[model samples]
Target chain A: MEEIRAEFSRIYDTYNGKIYRFIYLKVESREVAEDLASEVFLDAWKAFQKGQNPEPKIKNVQAYLYQIARNAVSDHHTSKKFKTVSVEGHMDIQDTGDPVEEQAAISIEIERVRGVLKTLKDEYQDLIIWKYLDELTYPEIAQITGKTEDTLRVNMHRAMQALKGRLEPGVTPEPVLGT
Target chain B: MREKDIIAKFTILKQIEPRQEWVRLTKQRIMGVPIHERFGFIDIVSYPSFFRISNLSYLVRKPAFALAAFILLLAGGVALQVTNQKLQNGLSLAEEEYQDTLASLELAQAQLQELRVAVEDNDTEKVSLAVKSFEERNAQASKDFVKLVENSSKKALQAGMKLVQLQKEKSQLERVLGTTLGEEKNEELENATKTLIEQELSDLENRTLTEEQQQLFAEAKAAYDDADYATALEKVWMLSQ
Candidate 1:
């Protein structure tokens, strides 16, 4: 019991902030991030008590965490019952102070990228974002995405090619001077 | 292939921020669970439901357990501090012995040189006896030098061992720390400790060693020329300190 208390204290001291930041970045609101961060710990606690995380033999703790976060996000989306809240109802965007505007600009860009990402299959979107945005390794991504390394590599290649094809004509409408 | 396109896409993605309310709601829901359920800190206090009537007393014993845990943590911290001080004292003593041994070596070397010069100048009758005396003294100084070196090496090894132990302890402590707070909230404290220790160790070692070692080397050289091997060894030992 003493050992367990000490262990809990140590883990809490180390990871509390990083987990919060990760959730905050994903959710983009302090309150939401705080909530998700708490849930992540709750999930971690349950896993620990059940002895389900046996030294992370299959997936690293970090990867496991992202997986949980992904599921949470997915559940959040689904629990809304696919009700497409009208654009006019999105009052979260009403406040347009300079900082908020700046954030909105960045979020807008992210949304645009997400829209394009929606064109691809879920696996492609996950793979591309986990690789590029989250910067997870192939093995790590494989653990999270449930894809083999070979498949991840092939999909990544295909995803890049597809994105390139979509983006090239729009970005490179004119020839360069050197060419 | 196209950096521009990739950057554009990333920029677009960055703009679509997730609703902040989702994080808030998630946190609220998560916090609704008991602390033990939050990160697996083995909350025997809150887990009374798992056990039958026999374990009800154990669950009711949380306040006492929490108090005991707090006391134990405080004791551990105190023990760490005490161990640290003991190590520092040991290092200081080893350093002092090393300095004394180096000074002795230098004194012996200087005496040897003086004896050699005396023999060359046909002052053998006068300095041959000095030579014999110095040789005996040199042997003693050499023994001291060896002992000093061994002592310093042992001290270094002990310090390294302690560091390894501390690192393990830190790792264990980190896991406990990580489970308490919500994820992402505790990174600052962790990073701060890591950075402070890394920076301070480098700075302290550099500043303490450079000037001290140079002075001891100069003293050792002077003692060597004076035919004082004992003094020379002591000075060299000081450099290590």
Candidate 2:
């Protein structure tokens, strides 16, 4: 039991930030994200105590946690606790240096892209967040989404196309770059 | 915007993060305190049940419950401090045994080094005196270890004790290796002892060993009497050096 708790604590320390960020990006409300993210771990802990952790038993912890966080966000979407987009939860864009000026410009561009990314469907948002941001591999993404790697490749292509369409006005549509 | 720019902008969202305090609190609520064998020293700020910080937050935030929480914490703190004091008091025997054992281990390792050099020089009298000194040190270590190993439920203690006994056997084997092995059985015994001791002392003999062995032993005793034998074993190697 002691070993179990210590191991889980290590797992929590490793993945909490990423899990929290993923939930926050999807929900866009810090309070709801906190509630749901904590809920995700609590749920994971329960599964873990039952020797039902998908990690160690099957494959990787990253996929198992993202799967839990994704379901947690889905549960919140259907629940009364979720808000559309809380004004208080608006992200404070941070960074700087002519190098500073360039950084600030980049930050603003990131926010602009974030706005457009938010406009995309949640599934598209998840793909972009996992692929381009989290940089998870196709197999890892497959474990979380329970989709085939080929299907994820196709979805990622579409998500990237949709994001690129919003970010650029006049761009020739392409379905595959990294895919 | 280009294709690269779109990908870069999306990637920049990686910087988005929840507040650190929220993360901590959420983890506390989600994971409470980790399970340790026991909390001695000033390890955890709260006692087991009373300071489950997660369970208390909502109640503690209530207007009526703040003073009650403070008083409960104060009482828990006092009780924990008293219990820890008793545990520290109880640690004296283990501390003494560990310190004495560490001394014997350090002495044995130094004597082993002396024996090895004496053997290399083929100095019979010097080798004899070193072996005699090592025999005495090995004897002392055996006594220290017998008491120490009795308290210890460590595979490491068993392995370490085997190494020490092999040192005694080395008094015989090196004598044989110093001259020549008697028969097939004696030759095998000499070979095995040298191999095991050499393997065990490979990393250990390289150190300029110090008082850390005592502390490591006592910590192993205090931390996990049965569990942290590997640390105790490391301390044994520190001496076998």
Candidate 3:
């Protein structure tokens, strides 16, 4: 019992901040992310209590958290009654990047992309956000979204082109992927 | 860079600042729970990673999760080592303090015995004015005994205070120092001065002496109080012999 407590304590000490940041970045809702993060650890604790070695089961608790977070967001979407509301009311877009000019330009570009993201279908948005925004590999996306990696790859490519075509004429954003 | 690569890197950079309040709330929420509560039969049944997320493409993509886990494990190892050292040092100091207290108590008892015996032996004329010397020594021993008792009690009280103080310090240090012993060791060193004081103070509480010494003190005190300077001088000389 003591050993388990020590183990969790060590895990918490190490990854608490990082996991929270990951969750926050995804849900963009402090309340929902906080609730889901607790659920994540509570689930971890339950696994530990059942005599499972967490180190083997969860390769990375942080990634696992992001996985949970994505589901939580989807769940929120499914469970809600209202329209898809952006959690951007409290978001300070200005704080997204470094103060350097290049970074500032990138930040503006990302915000522009995000603005365009809202126009895509929810599934397309999920793939684009997970691939480009969340930075998950195809497998991680497959794991989170229940999609095959091949399908995810094709969807991602199509999503990017669709997004690029939707960009106002002459913006001609560069290709997202190299051939 | 391709727009996709730019977007990917841009996303990562956007995440760097991370909403502080969100992170704080999440940490507070999940950090307290144990690790096992995280898994559920439902999660296993719904294991997206097993069926839904698997693909050959995953084999080709870089393994970010594996890298993150390795880094966290490394950090955890260093932290554990540092904390272990500090806890060991604290325990060692506590053991030393216990030993020092025992030694001081024994020394106090021994000196008290010698003073008592000197009083009992009525050898003043032969031994540099025995009665006056014995009386002076007896008074000094009594004062020392009182001081020993006072100092011991004081130290005991101080230890209690120290325990509270250390606990508070430990909690605070856990913040700035973190769980690793490396950060905490410096704080321990600073706090060590207090531990030494407690050690010196505790020794006065338990100075051990033989029954013979007790008898000598009792007899000498009785003789001295009764004003039997001659009889006291006799017992004093006998003990010395």
List model 1 lDDT by residue over B82-120, tens digit each.
767866886787788766655655665566556556545
- lDDT string, candidate 3, B1-241, tens digits: 3555535533643443334434444544644444333321122333345233345345347576567555756875886797678667755655555445444444434443443354356333322333233323333333332233233433333333323333343344335422311121222222333333334323422555367855754574466457543334334334433
C-alpha lDDT (0 to 100) for residue B61 of candidate 2: 64
- Chain B alone, TM-score of each model? 0.33, 0.35, 0.25
Q: lDDT per residue, candidate 2, B1-241, as tens digits?
A: 5668778657777767665546666777776754232333445544466467787877756969878888988987998888778777646756676667777777877887787787778787776567567656765665566555444323224445554454555656566544321111222223333333344444444655457754544553442344333344444555544
lDDT of 3 by residue, A42-129 (tens): 6776665565454456655555655665566567657764235445433223332232234445545555554555456667766765
Would you estimate the TM-scores of all the predictions? 0.36, 0.46, 0.37
Native-to-model Cα distance after best TM-score fit, residue B8 in candidate 2, in Å: 1.0
Weakest 10 consecutive residues, lDDT, candidate 3 chain B? B180-189
Query: Best-fitting candidate, measured by DockQ?
Result: 2
Between candidates 1 and 2, name the one with more favorable TM-score: 2
Worst 10 residues of 3 chain A by lDDT: A91-100
The whole-model lDDT of each prediction reads 0.50, 0.62, 0.48
How high is the lDDT of residue A62 in model 3? 51
True contacts kept of each: 0.22, 0.56, 0.16
Q: Which sequence of candidate numbers ranks them by TM-score, best first?
A: 2, 3, 1
